[model samples]
Target: MPSAPTVIQHPPRREGLGPPIAAGVVTALVGFTSSFAVVLAGLQSVGATQSQAASGLLALTLTFGAAILWLSWRSKMPVTLAWSTPGAALLASAGMVDGGWPAAVGAFLLVGVLILLTGLLPVLGRLMGRIPTALAQAMLAGVLLPLCLAPFKSLGTAPLLVGPVALCWLLLLKLAPRWAVPGALVVALAVIGIHLGVNGTYLPADALVPRLEWTTPAFSVEAAVGLALPLFIVTMASQNIPGVAVLKSFGFTTPWRSSMVMTGAGTMAGAVFGGHAINLAALSAALAAGEEAGRNPGQRWRAAFVSGLAYLVLAVFSAALVTVVAAAPPGLLEAVAGLALLGTLAAAISSALAEAEERVPACITFLLAASGLSFGGIGAAFWALTCGILVRWLLKPGPLVRKARGSGPRAPRQ
Candidate 1:
């Protein structure tokens, strides 16, 4: 018989320049294409000037990127951070009512404080632990599903550009999942080039320039109830919780509460700098946690630090970068994001329903989560858990003791 392949274990090494650079690029692109676009749109919808929105984006990118790098290095873990996309959506739905930008700042500050408090309070963390895992997974998947679907819809609007990209994605997914995203992006760019060759559409050459202007925070009960609480729920239920799960899936068991504490502290720091919600980034974690990050878990933080430095650079030139990124064809962004997320999506679903008994609860959570239900300023995640728990309780049968008593213990035949 052939000998079994030898398993070689060696100390982790610091990844070379190439992997860190690649990871940084992936992190930056995902941040730009995701809520960074939506946040700009939301702010614009609320009557904020373009400059203000651009400033906010700059603030978010720098704060989150720097925080991730710092914390990941300290913890010796590849802890990637990102803005809470669901929180941004909640902001969009609430619109820019009486307080406008000031309220947003105020809400961000308040939520950050609350998150910090959560970290300090062990009782709260214990309570969160009591919540069933299936429910938590369901809520997270529900929150992220909308984002995953967006890239596919772009094909309808720009078939000539998006179709080729989608095909490329499928091929890569089938043949080589690891390089699918960058590969799809290359194919999309090629398609764009061919179209431009025939129709002669001009692309922008201007760079994004960053400008900073601080808006004083205004606090009100309405803002607290309407914006702050929702932001907290989304950040906690939709971001931090799932982010920890992602790390666990990869077999890393860093202190969960400590990570939360850092994330909360980071959110507060971002608030002071005029950014929106910030939390751990499950997506970016994949970049640093990949085999390329380093064989040794201890060294993966380098990639995150590189990403952080890149974020700082981008923050310095926010306006120019935003314009340049915005000019990219939508298909290029969507196909790349979708291909990148497929693996994560599969892993999440598998973990969400690992137990057969938990499947029903998981299903309930998934449906409620996917429903995008909101009420009285609270977003879908909180409500989905509530509904899922209720269903689980209602469906549970009566205690076996009660059943035995009712049947008179098999008529004492024994």
Candidate 2:
């Protein structure tokens, strides 16, 4: 018999709660402030009034916070959960569904049902997995392009309002890459304040209180095919699956069944209160799972736990944040939203084009998505994936893929 493979195990990590606690704080801050604007924009796109949108924001924050706490504690892993930012970006691009807000809410409920079924049925997860990574990423990149362009576009239309926000983002990206978007948001708020003062804008009293608004859901064929399917795909492809991969990188096995079940349930519960979707944290998962959280993988779950508590604390101020956005000059907050999505868009594009053999198919997907094409009841995302995959199959590569595994792997992105 071959000699037993040498077993390697990490030395016991030093005992300390301080590092993980601090990491948790940073994780919450980065996770919330970085993409809250995207959440607001996405809700608005699907026809949410400002008050409804704020309620949606609060619901997502609370539900995911509770989910994270439960999962991390039960699984003993840094199992972070978040509102699906890419899914939000998709909604922002997909625009109003055929049946308006109730239909959109109904679609959100549909996404929840699908996600729950995915958890209960392993085949569903595998089926989603069969969607080619290139096409999926290409669709995401396509959805993101227009939103990402808002910053530079605003530079022409509202230069004074958006210019300083962009400058601050650029400056901090070099000094502290982690804080760039949040920093830009701060500057944008300041600009909004000046604008409000100059114009004597009066903020409504109700905008300062955290509240929940319930919308009775009503499904439509259009919303089911267009809004729900695409949202589910984006959350699964961009956030939930990648979140598992991220924790695995740090040597923690996510409890898949429990995670999906909890997140799916959370999504459904929050949808009645106007929340869109919640999924595993993709990028933010790293903040709680990485070595910065603690040398010991065992203790890092604490970081995720603390981060959950932090989100609940943050939820108290959701209405105020929305109030600020409502008062801001149009395109100013959108400019910040664009800045927030830049990194995600760049990563998506890189991943979509990683395989030299798949570049053409990916481009087709991207262009169709960006073109905002819709047919029948379906939107561009579904059509983009359909066309790209069909094109990819018809044009299979024989030679170009020989070295793709070696050459196309993204050292940074994955």
Highest lDDT scorer: 2
Residue 279 miss distance in model 1 (angstroms)? 2.7
User: In angstroms, how far off is 138's CA in candidate 2?
Assistant: 0.4
RMSD of 1: 6.6
What's the lDDT for residue 381 in model 2?
Answer: 90
lDDT of each residue in 59-142, candidate 2, tens digit only: 999999999999999988899999999999999999998889999999999999999999999999999999999999999999
What TM-score would candidate 1 get against the native? Answer: 0.70
* Model 2 residue pairs with clashes: none
Q: Which stretches of candidate 2 lie over 4 Å from their true place?
A: 1-14, 397-414
Stretches of candidate 1 above 4 Å error? 1-50, 85-104, 145-147, 175-207, 217-234, 237-258, 272-274, 289-291, 295-300, 316-318, 325-365, 372-382, 398-414
lDDT string, candidate 1, 370-390, tens digits: 676657645455677788888
